[model samples]
Each structure stands twice: as C-alpha cells, then as structure tokens.
Target: MPHKNLKQTGFDEMNLSPDVFAVLQTVGYEIPTPIQTLTIPRMIECKDLLGQARTGTGKTAAFALPLLSRINLENKRPQVLVVTPTRELAIQVAQSFNDYGAKMKGLNVLAVYGGQSYSVQLNQLKRGAHVIVGTPGRLMDHMRRKTLCLADLTGLVLDEADEMLQMGFIDDVEWILSQIPQPTQIALFSATMPAPIQKIAGKYLKNPEKVIIRQESDVTNTIHQKFLMVKNINKSDALVRILEASFHDGVIVFTRTRNDTMTLTKILEEKGFKTEALNGEIAQAARERTVNRLKNGSIDILVATDVAARGLDVDRISHVINYDMPSKIDPYIHRIGRTGRAGRTGEAILFVQPKEKWMLKQIEKATLRKIEEIALPSNREINEKRMDDFKNKIYQTIGTEDLCVFTDLVESTAKEQDISISQVAAALAKMLQGNTPFLPETMAHKSAAKKKGTKAEIKAKSPVAPKQKQTPARLTPNKIAPTEKGMERYRIEVGHKHGLKPGDVVGAISNESGLESKFIGAINIDYDYSLVDLPFGMPKNIFNLLKMTWVKSQKMSISKYAC
Candidate 1:
C-alpha cells in the first residue's frame, strides 16, 4: 500500500488553523495530498498561486481551508471569490468552504449561479456573504446588477481553468479577473495547463507559486475496473445481484440527472440498503446532510450526478459504481477517483450497454490508463461473503463481547427443553441466520460463465466477456429497445424557430439521461421543435420520464416525426 497523501506535508504544516486541523482529524484526513501540502502555505500567506492537479487529489480543501483562514470573517461583504465553469461546481466548492470553515466563527459562504430563482440569490447577498462561489454567467449578472461589489475582494480563485477555456468562458473569466481589486490574491487550479489559461495567469497573477501534483501513472493498477455488458432491460436485477455478490460497504452510484439520482436511491432503499441522493435540484443543506451521512456510517450508498459530486470526499468509500458511465473523461476519473484514496485499494464497477463501448475506449485514452475488466460478482461470491460476515461476527462476539447474559439464558432454555449443548448452539445459529442467503455451489459458475475469457498470466483482470448478441434477459429496465440497430428518430419542438443546434439537443438529452451524447443519432431541429433519432424502443418509463425533460427551459417531448 502507498502512503496516504492527505496528511503528507510540504511546507509549514504548522500554519494550518487549529479549527482546520480539528475538522481533518475528526474526518480521518491524515496526510496532505501533494497539492494540499504544497499549495496551502502559499495560499495561507495570501500569495498569488497556480496549482495543477487531477480531479481526486483534495485540491478543494487545499484552497478552501487556507482561504477560510485568510479571510476576515468579521466582514459581511464577499471577501473571497471563487469562479467555476458550472453551477454544480460552484455549489460544490461553496459547500467545501462551509465544511472546512464550520469551526471558524462568523464566516459566511454563499453559492451564486443561474438556473435558480434570482430573488433567493439577491436575498442571500442582502444578508451578506463573506465568501462567494459562483459561475461566470451568474457572477456577471450580479456584477452587472451592481448587487455584488468586488472592489474589496481579498482573494480570487478560478477552478477547473481549462474547462472554462473549453466552454468558451475564458474571456468572461479574464474580464472578471481584470475587474478585481489589484491587491487581491489569485489562485488557479486545472487538470491540464492549456496555453490560454497560462496566458491569463501570466497577465494577472503576480509572482505566483506553481504546484503540479503527479497523477498516478498506473491509475488502472490501483483501481479494479470492470464493466458488465448487459442490455438495458435486465440491469436493475443484475445490479442487485452484483451488490449482494460484492458486499461493498460505502458505495457511490452515478446517474445522469437529479431525477435519476433519486430514482436509483429509492431503488436501492427498497432493496434494503441505506441510500441517499445528491443532485443539482436538491437543497444545499440537504446535499451536505446526505454527503455527511455517506461519510459517517448512517448511509451506505449515494446516488448522484457528476455536478453534484464535485469536490466530494468520503474516505470510507469502498466502491464507485457507474450505473451510467460519464461521457467526459475527466469526470469519469473524478467519479472513480472517489474510491482508491489515501493509498487504499478500491474497486470501480462500470455497467455498459453494447452501444457504449466506444465511450469506454475514450475514457481509457483520456486518463492514459488501461483499465482491466473483471467478471461481475457471482451469486456464490455474495453468499460466501455473507457467510464470512456471519462467521466473523460470531467469532468477534465470542472473542471480545461478554456473552454471559445470553449464554445464561441459553443454558436456562436448554435445561428447560432438555437439549444438548451442540444442539442448542446449532439452533442458535439457525435463528441468527435471518435474511442472509445460504451460499449455493452453482452460483460461482453463473458469474464465471459470463466472462469472455480469463488469462492465467494476466496481472489486471480483463472485463467480463462482451455480451454476444445476448438475450433480452440481460437488458436493463430503463433501456429502450433499438429502433434500428444503428439509428432511430423522435420528435422535439425546438428547431429553426427556436434556433436549436445539435450540441444543444445532445447536451440536454445527455444531461437528462445517463446516455452518452454520442449514442444520440441524427438530430433535425425544426422551427418550433425538432426530431432526433435515438436508440429504438426507448424504455417506456424512461421515455415517459424524458418527455417532461426540458432544454432552454422548454419541455422536450417526442412523437412520430411529422416531417
């Protein structure tokens, strides 16, 4: 096992506030991740800085903690401002600031972004915010409205700088930066250091300290990656079976939209597992509560979208399940990156439809990592783990706990019934075996048979054998049947009249459904609406679900193409 990075130090570790240290200790954060160790000191000193790190390396806290320490909590005006490319990310970073600053007295943090009621945001600013985290569009809106004043801003941070550049928000970001008071501190963090970002930093930052944390060359090595090639129909049953078989403790299940995050969480709860949902629509207070539940022992599973999960850290997380794989590579890393933290090995399980394999390739290429596939856990594995847990519990009870009271009661019952010691013990074991499934022998073969091929010499396990034309029994419930194997069409209302574009439709669908944008076929936007070809036989429930989905705040519905 590698040494944990959260506590590993770089500069003056002693400079961290006692409150910050208290929170870290209570949460079991031990070492400083490379970025945290290197960047915290500079940030604490209120120095201009640049940090380059991958998605999962604790960058949020590195900037958040020190910024909290540097700010004047006594001031009601926004003292520190952090700009992210998306509303989800802005919310996430603001929450992080809240988490780390909870121990600090009088600190106020607010997240401002579009897609939410403006009055509520205005009210928050009216109430006063010391730390403001917001997206560019919304920030510009606030600046233009003169509701937010930046002349007294003490610190500014641009997170995921490269993503801002990609989304064509660089000019806005630069303009925002240009308007900040000259004496303010500046910090930027990005996975990739694109030229445009560098130019912005070169022009704005003064004698900035730069820290680039090394990404694991062997991301695939530390992570156990595998995908099941089930069709859309049978996925729910398959997931239940897989969860039972793996016995994962703390799990994160990814879905595409806020509704689906709740949907999956409800499903998992019905299956008898404690679960929670995190999404853009969820209240910020509720989001923090759910994440806290997942971090503590109160909840075992969290179902969330990519945006809802930004800067999320839960050290006990044992598994990251891609109920729906992400289209973007960096976010994929970010999702799976939840587990396998602090040098502890973790598992990543992906569920892929036959059409989504290309996305797998794209993800592999993006991370410069080759993920090995493995067979889904078999029924036998599930039963075996159950038995193991039962046996371990029994052993632990005998080893450490006082059994005198129970033992005396058992003795009295045995005496009253005239039963022997062995029989009594056997009867006790039987009664204790409540809901656990008995390990069945043939169950192991069920999982093994699903594999394509297993190599004896291979170090990383290969993915389960790709589904072969496979039967309908393997399909997931929400997946619709193919209209045509390669292409299909559905109607929408936003075509030429609405000035709809291909990317707009794709983004809307992908954001709403877990399906990758690439899976969407030809899109022809009409005047009022448009028609799009998607995988055939869209699952009735999902189709019904998507019918109410909206793009540009317009209902996205489908019918047989009119034109």
Candidate 2:
C-alpha cells in the first residue's frame, strides 16, 4: 500500500481477526501507527517484511500481533522465534504477546535471556512454548545445546537489528537465521538501515517488503527541546526548580549511573516529589512494580539509568529530563523518545555543564534542530509556584471535600480561646505547615543580580525613548528578530532582571501553551520584561494561561504590545 493510503487505515481495517480486534479494543488501541499500518498487513499475508522505525513507535505490536495470529495452539513447539539485542526487550516482547493474546487458550510464550536461571527456561521449553523471545547470545546457546528447537519454527524476527549489530551480535543473528528451517517467514526491524543490517536482510529475507516509518536521527517535532547550563554542584537545585516551574503529568529523569538513580530518587523524595528508582541493583519484581506505579499515576517521577529503562512504554510520560547527558547521540535520542509518543505532545530538558557543551552540539547536529538554552528558575519563582500549588490544593479540597467537621472544630477552638474563627484557622494552617518554610532563599541571586547590572549598563548605553515602540534595531544580540509576517507582539514580565533569556521565554511559552516552537516567533529580552511575537487570534483561555505562566522568577503577565 502507498504510504499516504496506509496512514489512513486503522487497526480494525487491517484484516485482523475478531479475537485480536477484541484484544486491541480491550487495550484501548484505537488507531494504528505508521509502522503498524504498513507492516501488519504484509506480515498477515505470510510475506517476509523489513521495517525501519525508532523506539516508542508501537513497533512491538506491529510484529507481535501477526506472530500471535499465526500461532497454532495444538502443536506448541516454538513455532515463532524473536531475537532481540537486550534481555529487557526480550521480556517486553514476550509480555506484549501475552497481553495481546490474553484470550488465546493454551498459548504459551517464553522469554529466554542471560542473568535468568537456565533451569526455568529448560523446564518451560520442555513443557512446550508456542513462541520464544530471546537475546541473540542466549538463544544461540540454547540452540547449540538442543534445548530450543527451530525445526518447527514457522516465523523469525530480528528486532532492533541495528542495535544487535552495534553490540557485535550480528554473527550470532546470522547463525540463528541459518538454523531456521525453510518456509519460515522473517521480519527484521531496525531503527537505522546501516550497510551491515542491509547485508543481513539481503542474505536472509526472501522478497521482503520494505516499510520505513522514521529515521533514527529524527525526533517528533511535537516535542519542545530545551537545555539548562548548570554546574555539577547546582544540578539538584536546578532540577528541582525546573520540575516546580513546569507542569507535567508524568516525568522520567535519566541519570548516567545506577548509583545516581538511587541518589537522585532519594533527593527528589525528600523534596516532596512522588518519585521512584529503577536500576540494575533492583530486583526484577521491584522494577516491574516501579514501572506499574508510574503507569497508574501512583508516582509522578522515575529516576532510571539507560539500561534499566529499555523497552519501557508508558503513554502518560509527559516529560523527559536528562539530569546527566548521555555519552552518545543514540542513547540521547532514545531517552527523549520516551515522551512525545503516539502523536501526543511532550517536552525534553537537558542539563548541560560548561565542559559538555561540545556534546550538546553533537546532539543538536544529529537531531538537526537547535536546543533552546533556558535559564534556571530563581528562588522567587520556585517559592511562588509552590505557594500557588498549595493554595490550589486547598481550594480543590474545599470544593470537592466535606469540611463540616473541620469547620466545627475551628469554631469551637475559636470560642474556647476567645479568638476569631479566622485566627483559629490560621493557627491550624501554621501548625500544618510544620517547620518547613513556605519560601526558601533564592540560590541564583548572585547570577540574577549580575545579569540585572549588565542590563542596566546596556540600557544606559542605548536607552529606548519614553513611550516609543521598541523596534528590531533596539533588540540585543541575544534576541531573535520578529521576522514572520502577521505576527502579534506580546510582552511578558520576565527578562534580564529575572535572569531570563530569549530561549527561556520560547521554551516556557511553547511547552505550556502546546504551541510548536516554529510558530513561536522572535524574542526580545530587556531589563525587567521581554517582548515576543506569536500567531494572532490565540484563544482567550490560552492567552490567560500564558499570562499566568511563570518563567525565571516572575509571572509572564502576558499582554498585547501597544507600541
């Protein structure tokens, strides 16, 4: 099918069985992704298929559904073999098959990989498994020992083919493919089509139909990318500030090491964020529980290393924060790809140190987009946000909860103490606040003050005439000129005084308003406020939200520019 026509097809229209359609409905899958829409029909027709797609594109279901549909329950002797690069992926693929084939009786699926007990796999294989998902190395071992028989295998899949090649498992993959008997349909999926992966496809696949959904260096344009320059000592503080200043439903913070995951998790928890940690040190069961917690909204933040977070698919991940930048561009892409998935908009924030600016450039070059640099939120901003959140909580409780008992207690306490009821309530609130201060000291004050002084110097050197409109020539070197036609100029109450930069303004407005960065026009930062160009005819509600939004250390207070 043509790409455009395929994009219009839904999962139900892809010739899926009623049982599979029921399962898809139960799992709340309404539409098909690009890869799924094109690959599923070809796989269902028993044709060899090759797909090029990135992570988080719903590729697992694209292959799993067709494999499950082709399974024969009566003869369960490993009819399908799925080879992946990592154990986590193996387990995830096995779980997808199980979840999608929940109603299929006597359909057994097994995941075999290293670090797992051999006895468990042996017993499961002996009992009979309709499908096997495994890593290349372990699957090769099983095949050599005659524990896993490919004699009855009717289908084969090499998932993450490029990743397997990078891990030096291409030889093993080829050996395993050579072992599979004739007449078995093959499906190979990779994020990138390197020459090595292409060689494998040419050698093994028979008249394979190609489906390229996305390129590896490509990121969803819906994701707003931003970065912060922070010192190593101040990373924790900066992270807290960003979390407080931005609104998100579920967040994943990536760290470089396992120990960092635990450390950050503890710190975030102490700071009153609902957080969890996923690392290699944790048991598999605990990791599963942590992931489940994230999915169910029991926790809002997850701190994890790259290895531990592989094959993680959660639709609610609204933001991805790179606390420590990855060493390579592929991992960086994979990390942020966790969000901005399934056509939903998301945001990614990177914390870059002065020394790592080169690495930031590498990422930007690879992704083919500029990573907007944003200032760290000042202490005043964090305090105001916390106060607003606390007040909102109280208001929500009053509107949705029964407070008669609390009101009576307050009234009685007021009468007994010979004070007003309002005083009693104030005392109760103070007691509830405990020893924690409502506002903490501003940590970024020195930098903010220095920026303010610099802004004053610039203003004195080149002052704007009183009550005159600021033109493009009046903008500083750090500002972007308003070049788009029909752009409406709006002023926000945050600028050099608040340590605000042009990119900081762009990031905040784009993320909070769900406006694409392309639509966010030029930015002009001044001493105590900034001017930005945006598309005209914005909705009243969105304009109000933009007004109330917080940037560096103050509310945007957004308004149309008069001059």
C-alpha lDDT score of every prediction, in listed order: 0.77, 0.84
In candidate 2, stretches whose alpha carbon ends up further than 4 angstroms from where it belongs are 1-7, 215-219, 231-233, 395-404, 442-563
lDDT of 1 by residue, 103-154 (tens): 8887789999875568889999999999999989989989989999887798
Model 1 has a clash total of: 37
**TM-scores for all candidates?**
0.64, 0.72
| lDDT measured at residue 474 in model 2 versus the true structure, 0 to 100 | 40
Model 1 global lDDT (CA atoms, 0 to 1): 0.77
Candidate 2 clashes between residue pairs 3 or more apart in a chain or in different chains: none
lDDT of 2 by residue, 84-160 (tens): 88777788789999999988889899999876668889999999999899998889999999999888888899998
Candidate No. with top TM-score:
2
Give the RMSD in angstroms, all C-alphas superposed, for model 1.
14.4
Report residue 268 deviation for candidate 1 (angstroms).
3.4
